[model samples]
Target: MNSPPHPPRQALPTHGTTLTPQAFRTLQAMALGGLLVLVLGWFYSPLRIWSNLLVVAYYLVTLALGGALFLALTYVTGAGWHVAFRRIPEAMASLVPKTGIAILVVLALRMNQYGWQLHAGAPEGTDAGTYWFKQLWLDPPFWMARAAIYVLLWSVLALSLVAFSRRQDRLNPQELPRAIGSMKWSVRLSALFLVVYSITFSLASVDWIMALEPMWFSTMWGVYQFAGMIQATLAAIVIVGLLLRRPGRLLYGIFRTDHLHDLGKLLLGFSCFWMYIWFSQFMLIWYTNIPEETSYYIARMHGPWGPVVLVSVLLNWIIPFFVLLPKPCKRSEHVMMKVAVVVLIGRWVDLTVMVFPSTVGKLPVLGIWEISGACCMIGIFGLLFFKALTKSAPAPKNDPYYGESLSYHCS
Candidate 1:
């Protein structure tokens, strides 16, 4: 027999969600305490502190950028399922400007650590590839200018897309035509943003991370970074979605398990993609057996760093792939949250593996310096995210597809 009609439900909340006073204080303490430790460590080991700062700052930037990329993608593809909890990604993207500034500061202080920056001149017998890279591409002023351009362009586009969404929220139902027009413009802007973002973000991966080991270059480095960004970003969305699903919360009745399942699917897909890119790069380099190319892997794959790499793979791919394979695991709040936490931690470790070996060249250590720096960044991220979350309605109400989003379900 067919089911009877259900009663009408209460409307979604109009206002944004706020952080409790105690929660605000906790994040404040975490940020400050971590800063104090980093400052104290700077006196004792400035290089270590700088390295950690660079890693964490880059991590922060990628997370925010990933959020923007997510928005641009969904908008361009006309994906409406995310409309119900779109504010989470918007809040996440709003951190781009703040994190952009953070990254510039770190780059100013630490760009010298890159091998290209330290080389006064290419030595005799330098290959044509290395020569051009050093002379044309690695010019410090040009590099900095490019970095500035990337940051400025991305900040404008990210914030503009966000502004467009917020503007749509003010329109009444009678203004349906205007909302549709706005979405059309959004589609155009998002398409432009993606074209720009793909090129810039790829170059960014080369300039920021790959350049650290100046002599070692992988053609797929950009793809590798992109995969990790999406994987971690999806994990972050899941965590935030679950948090907002708490009783009396903004997304209490809005963000559903079906949505979580979709996020989990993306998480699993990207984890596999990340591994594929990683293996492709590693396998190609190994097959070629080029000394310069092999040196990068040698540094990371041998000695103390070997175990770290193993753990990173396990956390980033092995664990998530298996855990999320089962359908129920993806739909369970506790299960999804734990996996998201694992992916986030794995992202940090994966970045650490990429950075530390190039800078410190020592065994991996999650000592006071690394731990505190992470605490500081995580705290800052939380504070900014919640602040952005409270700036508008917890869920977008004027998005043309908002109704469809509310009724979204998996078959």
Candidate 2:
């Protein structure tokens, strides 16, 4: 018996096309405007400004980290369907080290404000020695060192893979053996990065965000962060893919309904996964009725933050779940783009719920601080990502799996 015929192959454009000059100028203006707003907001409400900073920084890092994870998973699994769109994630991954440094700068500036130092007093009935031990473990210097290590590891892995991939573009397509040989190191490094990422990302979540409430603890917190990261990252990828598919764009003709459908499925699945993690964390804490853990919920469940929490759920899961269920929605580029936008905004709200209650407390205020901070970070991300995209072919022309990816289709 013979194998089934592949879908018709499509022509891919060569590299060198860049973002329009007008587009670059617009993005640069947004970046500067956002920075100005953040600066002005800082003078009015320092606490709110700082909280927004943390939220934005962490959100950017998750995006970059998600990109790395996407690449690693595809490489390890030998997935070929995404080879045409891999450059987007590669560019996103390259932003990781820069975002890490930005996060470190924020932490250094706000070192005195973290609540861990106050935990030295120990709770009633708790042993002082144990409390002090925990405090020592969370020492600011050690926390900073771990963050640097995570960034260093991610930077090395992402840059190495990109270097090898770009080098392939310059090689002769007939050198199939050399092409395969070039990708072998990426596979090996991806495997290693996956292991390192699982451990370090979890620890980083605990150290950076969870540590805000030094008294509260959740075993599921890391998973919660990871789930949200994946959802947001998928939404971002879909959005970028759509944008690049426009006429005269670098990625035109490369992405098809099948690729969009596959991406949509992942987006749908991860949206539910994020909700599951969210509910599990909430249920376990609510049922156990532990004051320490419950306090974390109490801060958000009451007052102004409560409504935002509900909206976050609806935007992130409920809407996307129902909307993407139909076959048509997933396959349609316009429909998926709308869903992706909602999920992206939902992700910002989710991150807000996580950081604001701990930092700003009962006074859940959203003003120039939140808006400016988000705009600034997003503007920076756009600038860096588009810059990276211009550095190489938007699609991997010489990839071993490029032909298969171009010809991929659903039954």
List pairs with backbone clashes in candidate 1. Answer: none
The prediction achieving the highest lDDT against the true structure is 1
TM-score of 1: 0.95
- Candidate 2, residues 1-411, lDDT tens digits: the string is 222332344445665354678988878887888889877877888878888888888999899989989998999999999998899888888888888888888877687565555545777754465577667767777777887888788788777777877888888757867888888888998898889888989988888888888777899998999999999999999998888877677777776667889999999999999999999999999999988678889998878889999999999999999999998898888899999999999999999998889888886677766888878887888898888888887788788998888776764
In order, what lDDT does every prediction score? 0.86, 0.84
lDDT of 2 at 22: 90
Colliding pairs, model 2: none
Question: Can you give the lDDT of residue 174 in candidate 2?
Answer: 72
Best by TM-score: 1
User: Lowest summed lDDT over 10 consecutive residues: which window, candidate 1?
Assistant: 1-10
